[model samples]
Target: MTRATFEIEITPNETPLLPGVGRFDFQKVWEGDMQGRSVGLMLSAGDPASGTAGYVCMEVFEGTVDGKLGTLAFQQLGTMDGGNQGLRYIIVPGSGTGELEGAIGVLNLTVDEGTGEHSILLEMSSDH
Candidate 1:
């Protein structure tokens, strides 16, 4: 089984690039499900109301790939366009599966129309 948890911080939204406006920062933690390699988020652009994109970083803290400690780096999970996309995860190899228990990461979020800005707060979690 896998579990995902997150905390968000909002920022000013961009306008002329989006109608539904808001920005968010992501901080999340996960428990490995697929042999401790479980990481990633399934993103959806909410609706036609959502006219922005989403990008995030996934990092590993306490983990190993074949016994070698995992590195601290952020990989682009994917783009969350204005539509419904399925679930996904960041790959940390042997590190995420069972090597990590006190890992930390950050998520930089945005929502805009390229004119104005609005930031929102959201907390989300999932387990499977």
Candidate 2:
């Protein structure tokens, strides 16, 4: 397993998808073992302002993981309620290309409340 950390920037899309849903586009700059950038789209529902909400996102990451260069896709699901939060990030099956062919992994994310900083911890492996 490999662990990597990253920082992210999220921008809200002006175009509304639904009455109560929000759309966003995000970019991540990864560091540590995995070095590169990723772009993703997110759809969210409910109200985070009231401390309850859910979101789903799909990201395409282009980078070098442990010196192997390739691209991988990830699916992310997350929810937050009050002081509790749950998140899961999984590599999309058969979505690996180049040196990362047949890659699989789970990623965990963390946010620092005091600094409003976001980071990720990726546990990744490949069939190749």
Task: Tell me how far the alpha carbon of residue 1 in candidate 2 is from the true structure, in angstroms, after superposition.
Answer: 3.0
**Residue 85 in model 2: lDDT:** 90
lDDT of 2 by residue, 9-110 (tens): 899998968998999999999887888899999999998989899999999999998889999999999999997999888999899999999999888877
lDDT by candidate, in order shown: 0.35, 0.88
> What value does the lDDT take at residue 26 in candidate 2?
96
lDDT of 2 at 99: 92
What is the alpha-carbon RMSD of candidate 2 to the true structure?
Answer: 1.5
- What value does the lDDT take at residue 100 in candidate 1? 38
lDDT of 2 at 35: 88
The alpha-carbon root-mean-square deviation between model 1 and the true structure, to one decimal in Å, is 12.1
Off by over 4 Å in 2: none
